[model samples]
Target: MKIKNLSLLVAMMGGAPAIALASGYHFGSQSVSAQGTAFASGAEAADASTIFYNPAGMSRLQGTQFSGGLTFVLPNSDYSDKGSTNYLKRPTGGGDGGSFAPDIVVAPSMYLTHQINDQITAGIGMFVPYGASLDYGGDWVGRYGLTKIDLMTININPSISFKLNDHHSFGFGVSAQYMNAELDKASDAVTGLRMGAAAGAFGPASSAITNLINAGAISGAGTIKIKGNDWGYGFNLGYMYTLDENTRFGIAYRSAISQKLRGSANWDFSGVNMTSAVPGRFRVQSTAG
Candidate 1:
């Protein structure tokens, strides 16, 4: 039942069977919490990702310090819609209208932090800040709307923190970013035109088939392929402050990165069979508040 509604929405979007997303499907799970204590000391004392958060905290640690953990994500995204028709024929085979659905998906991450010095601390963390993927049922009424999508991001960050004084400090890091992106969408069905044509201009639908008839409005069906990936480098800078023994604050800014992905999208049909060679850059920015 829901799938039908999904298909309808996809159809409205001028696509195949479903619609899912905010740009590419990659929304790296590298949530703000990982920076955990880096943003708020109150939160940091509880976890280890702090190695990546505010490694400088090591300066405050006594002996050896180590921290590591992983994050798992499950996203629920889908579509639903109604069917379009001309004559009021009770839908044959008492069944539902239409639908579009996405499978459950998960993305993971891990990081470690160990205090190395009293004033200068160092740590390493591997994480995916952005990642997500989705697929539509192939048999959907609007299969040509959106078929598939995938995107991923991985960051290997090694950082160091310095304690300038009891009240404030500074930290810096060299970041290596890896990115992968995929976008796939289908052409229009023009099913409306074909159905309308079959209903009108004369013949019964059963007979319409024999006549090899349908509205000419359905110019044609097309397909598109969009996929790309790129790798780049950047940096993260942070400042930490101790308001008191129980409270502290941290601010960090990650530089922007430009990922160049290369791919192609083509349209197939009668007179206008065309192909478009596609390539573009995906930019990313990180901010902590």
Candidate 2:
């Protein structure tokens, strides 16, 4: 779907105008059969894909059944400058970020169900529930705020359903989810140099560093990249009630999964070659969250 005029507002300190851009990252359509009605048909329990929407529907399958498909996601992120400014309150330089969203994303889904008996069914499903990928390059005006980001997750669900009578069915499932993320942003080079000087790391070359910065030998820009991955656990429950053969009612709940990522933060200055003068000065730091 094409999202338009959706703005992501970032509060600017000191009254500077904020930068706005389109920002939505959840992909909810996991079943192709349910998509035409925007998933309102989930309660219909028509196929094995129900292992994802309402597992109780698995009881409706007569025998071993399988369903699989892919969903293509194409997103566009067009940025327009709204008087954006840097932390120094100077006009944020560089072009308005171009279309940074990936041209296409393939989300895959698969489900398998087997009727265990007259009243029980077992199933398993795999799907992507959340994802995002974008890259504004290195020279955009909003680089400091966020230059690039890529996040992806996969969920595996093993479920069981019980048909209690002509009208009642219940389902339960547990999930094991995996998530990975990477982010990039510009950091202030001048601030880093000042920190080094203040800590006396520059020693006798402190004044020389200031002169280089003042003479434009340094562009006062750096880049920081963060990467991480983790696994989380959750569960889902559903209940379906068949009212006559033509009518049905259903309710479902999914638990929230929390992930703590262990990763690293890598950064380096872009303009000047300071590594030769201060070997190993720019270092990668370990991080966790």
Each prediction's number of clashing residue pairs: 21, 0
What does candidate 1's lDDT look like per residue over 1-289, in tens digits?
A: 0212222212322323334344544533343464453443432534445545555454455555455445544445545446632122322121121322234544555555555665776766677766656666433444454566677788888877788889787877777888876655544534432444344522343244323323232233444455556778877777778889877777767787776655443333232121221111111111111
Off by over 4 Å in 2: 1-24, 194-208, 274-289
Q: Residue by residue across 98-217, what tens digits does model 2's lDDT show?
A: 998888988898999999999999999999987888888888888877888888899999999999998999999999999988878776555456445545555787777667656656
Mark the regions of model 1 whose C-alpha exceeds 4 Å error after superposition.
Answer: 1-47, 55-58, 61-65, 82-103, 188-222, 264-289
Q: What local distance difference test score does each model get?
A: 0.50, 0.73
TM-score, one value per model: 0.58, 0.82
lDDT of 1: 0.50
Which pairs of residues collide in model 2?
Answer: none
What TM-score, to 2 decimals, does candidate 1 have? 0.58
